[model samples]
Each structure stands twice: as structure tokens, then as C-alpha cells.
Target: MRPLPLSDEDHQMLLKHGKELSDHERRITDLNNKMTDTLKSVDESNKYLREQNNHILEAIIKGNEKNDTHKQEMEVINRQNLWKVVTIAIGSSSVIYLILQQLIHVIH
Candidate 1:
């Protein structure tokens, strides 16, 4: 098959268009590379944030456990204090009665 020959001016135009196409291809390739890098950076950030959130949740759970233990200890201490108060009030009433009896005898 015979090849069709292009005139000199047509050849120049074809060469110019090919160069422009190469430039557009290079730009598209660079843009794709940049987009891929950006996605990777975003993925790494997400992972870091997830780790931080996990640590915070774990710390919160530990704090809650400590609070529960403190509450139980406080409840026990309050019960003991209540019993001591009751005992002190009974002893004080007995002493007051004894003193009143002694005063009445002395007056008589």
C-alpha cells in the first residue's frame, strides 16, 4: 500500500499538535500523581486520629473504673460514720440522765 505524503506545512502542523498533546499528557500524569499523594496523606491522618480516639476512650474507661471504686469506698465510709454517730448519741443521753438523777438527789 502506498503511503500518503503530507505537504511541508501539514507536517509542521502535525508536529505542533503532537507536542501539545504530549504536554497535556504530562500535565495529566502529574495531576494524577499529586492526587494519589494527597489521598495517602489523608489516609494517614485518619489512622492517626483513630489511634488518638482509641487512647482517649481507654483513658475514659479507666477513669470511670476509678470513679466507681471511689464511690464504693465513700459509701462504706459513710455507713461506718453513721454507726459511730448513733453510738455517740446513745452514750451522751445516758450520761445526761445520770447527771440529772444526781442533781435531784442533791437538791432533795
Candidate 2:
């Protein structure tokens, strides 16, 4: 169908409204682009932080393992030392008892 001709005043109004719509569309596009860039930057930052956190956790686990090994070694050393002290105390007591018995027999 053939379109009806617009009057001058109607044409002017339509032009004005078209310009305003174009401006709004451009502003919306700019805002959408900015939002996309911001989201990409945030995603990159999150990825970097996750990698660093994984490294830190691995280091902590290694440190804990080393600590456990040292504790076990110390426990073994302490047990050995305790046994040595007990042996020495028993030997000294036996010798003292023998010496006292011999001295009493000679005096009587």
C-alpha cells in the first residue's frame, strides 16, 4: 500500500524523535560495552587469585608433612634416651647392693 504524505510539522516532530532514539541507543551500547569489559577484567582477576591460592595451599601441605617427619624422629630419639637412663640406674643399684653386702660380712 502507498504511504500517506506527512505534513511539514509532522515530519519535523518525527525527525526530532528519531534523533532522540538514536542518542539513547548509542548510550545504551556504550554502557553495555563498558559492562562487558568490567566483567572480563573481574574474571581474569579471579583466575589469577585461584592460581595463587592453590600454590599457597600446596606449600602449606609440604610444610605440614615436614613437621610430621621431624616429630616422629624426635619421638624416636627421646625413647632411646629414656631406655639408656633406665639401664644406667639399674646397673648402679646392683653394684651398690653387692658392695654393701661384702662390707657387712667383713665387719661381722
Quick one: best lDDT, which candidate? 1
Worst 10 residues of 1 by lDDT: 2-11
* Stretches > 4 Å off in candidate 2: 102-108
RMSD of 1: 1.7
Off by over 4 Å in 1: none
| Residues 1-108 of candidate 1: C-alpha lDDT, one tens digit per residue | 998999999999999999999999999999999999999999999999999999999999999999999999999999999999999999999999999999999999
Please give the lDDT score for candidate 1. Answer: 0.99
Cα lDDT for residue 92, candidate 2: 94
Please give each candidate's TM-score: 0.84, 0.83
Candidate 1 TM-score to native: 0.84
Weakest lDDT window of 10 consecutive positions for candidate 2: 88-97
